[model samples]
Target: MTGSLQGETVLVVGRGSGIARAIVGAAAAEGAQVVAAGRNREALESAYKGTSVSVKGVDLTDEASIAALADDVGSVHHVVSTASARARGALGELSPEAILLSFHTKVVGPIMLAKHFAPEMPRTGSLVFFSGVAALEPDPGFLGVAATNGSVNVVIRSLAVELAPLRVNAISPGTVDTGAWDGLGEKKGAFLEKLSAANPARRLGTPEDIAQAVVFAMTNTFMTGVSLAVDGGQPLV
Candidate 1:
């Protein structure tokens, strides 16, 4: 890290846990004034405890709420949205509401962020959106997740061109050991082990891995409209 972000302001949405929290810490360590935004105030507070990060509440599904956050945040040097609605099940078992909500959270929300925040972003500023490896290597029960994340790749490409000079890109991660897998309880470790053995890297990804990719996307002035996969070769095999 070259400390290139020093003295810049970075707004990281979805700071509840997992990769988002890691990103907040990494940005602050790089000397950025980090603003952590999420729907859960308590979670945000907990994740950013003892840090100088500012916390704010913003609901991705609500346009007015995102606009309000933009108004409050004012100008920013970069923005990254890790916000996602967790809705997964087999195709026949899933609900329409859950599927729609997933798209709204991952797809619509980022669009709204660009709609409102683009004007405030300088030519050198960038926007990074999070996608997932499931979009490339689909499984049986992750239909909605694959669809939503796949859409993000398309959205970022279009936005990069439309937004021009204000670089836009996406990061697609593989199975990472984030709190999102806590529901597996005692089986979480074994599950991760299985995935690790299958991956070419022979390990599950860490939040730090994803955070580093995000920082790279933000600072690489020559990169844009690209969906870089930090999946430890999960998509390859």
Candidate 2:
């Protein structure tokens, strides 16, 4: 790590595992004071125990919770949100509630975080949100997921323009072995193998892959309103 974020404070909003956990570790490795926040404050605290990361509670679906978190965290140099509610199912199996939850958690939540946290961040500060390859390479049984991620890819552009000197970007990941596919159960290994073969890189992604891209986005002042695809060229094929 170049310690590009040395002395800077980074706030990462998400659960205490998978990509979110990896992001926290990555930011800390870059010499930033990282805060791991989510709805489960206790879990975060426990997960990050014995580490430098601090834990806080914030519900993405609720504005009041976000505002309260902003008040608690006060000033921050960079903020990264990795929270997402995936509605994985075909059109017929999808419910209105699931779609709405996906949109609210992945799309609307990051926007609100920017709104409240922007006031406290400096001009050089950046905001990184999580998008996914589902948006770029649409697939069946993930319509809601695609729509939610697609919205994020667009919103960051508007946010960058509106926020000006404050950088806004997103990290779009492909099939990362962050245990997200664990729900696939017995088929998880075969599914990953198939994806790896199809991907141009001939491999599935990892949480560290996405986290490294996020660090780049946050530190590169020239980059904004862009969605960095750290999908190992999965979208290429």
Candidate 3:
């Protein structure tokens, strides 16, 4: 419980983004053998570039794919999933397909992951799922995101109880400069500025911020059945 993961293996799903890359780097720095899993093999490999982290392809929405991934990986000391589907809209304005995909990505995917990978994890191992501040603030246009993330919070608690010694927890992050808003062009800066002003922390989160929280959750032996809000007081504001 007080030791490092020097010889442990960590499997990080959704390795194509800045946050996932940061988590991979942090874990590797902790001396854990890191495995990056994503739907795109090329992207996964590209994310690790010159690093020794191994890359694997796994579609979270597909049970068979996840099963195959678990089998191939054999055993792991921890699992962290950053995979998410972008689904945003008003209550009645959103497409059903989009809503379903959101559920698949944020909810069902983790469920399947636990089903397949939990058995491979030892009691000291943990599963860290990603949630978001939308679930806490309930923004008007992010009904789907709120629903999926809120459900994840509940799922983590339930899985913690059911999985017993295998810890299950969630991290809910606020708006971060993870390049997801890069498509907004010039407006991205203004958007982040507004977000920073609204949050008590007065700054947008960095991928490193969330990654460190994830490493804590993964390594902390006493934590489980809880959602740690890494939102920089965005929900309180």
Question: Which candidate number has the best lDDT?
Answer: 2
**Per-residue lDDT tens digits of candidate 1, residues 108-220?**
99999999999998999999999899899989889999999999999999999999999999999999988788887899888888999999999999999999999999889
lDDT of 2 at 108: 93
Badly placed stretches (over 4 Å) of model 1 are none
Better of 2 and 3 by TM-score: 2
Q: How would you encode candidate 2's per-residue C-alpha lDDT over 1-237 as one tens digit per residue?
A: 889999999999998998899889999999999988999889998999999898899999999999999999999999999999999999999999999999899889999999999988999999999899999888999899999999999999999999989999999999988777899999999999999999989988888888889999999999999999999898788
**Residue lDDT tens for model 3, 123-195:** 8999999999998997887898999999999999999999989999999999999887777789988989999
Question: Clash number for every model?
Answer: 0, 0, 0
User: Against the unseen true structure, what C-alpha lDDT does each candidate score?
Assistant: 0.92, 0.93, 0.91
| Displacement of the residue 143 alpha carbon in candidate 1, Å | 0.7
| Per-model TM values vs. the true structure | 0.96, 0.98, 0.96
Scored by lDDT, model 1 comes in at 0.92
User: Which residue pairs does candidate 2 place in steric collision?
Assistant: none
Question: Which TM-score value belongs to model 1?
Answer: 0.96
Query: Candidate 3, overall lDDT?
Result: 0.91
Ranking by TM-score: 2, 1, 3
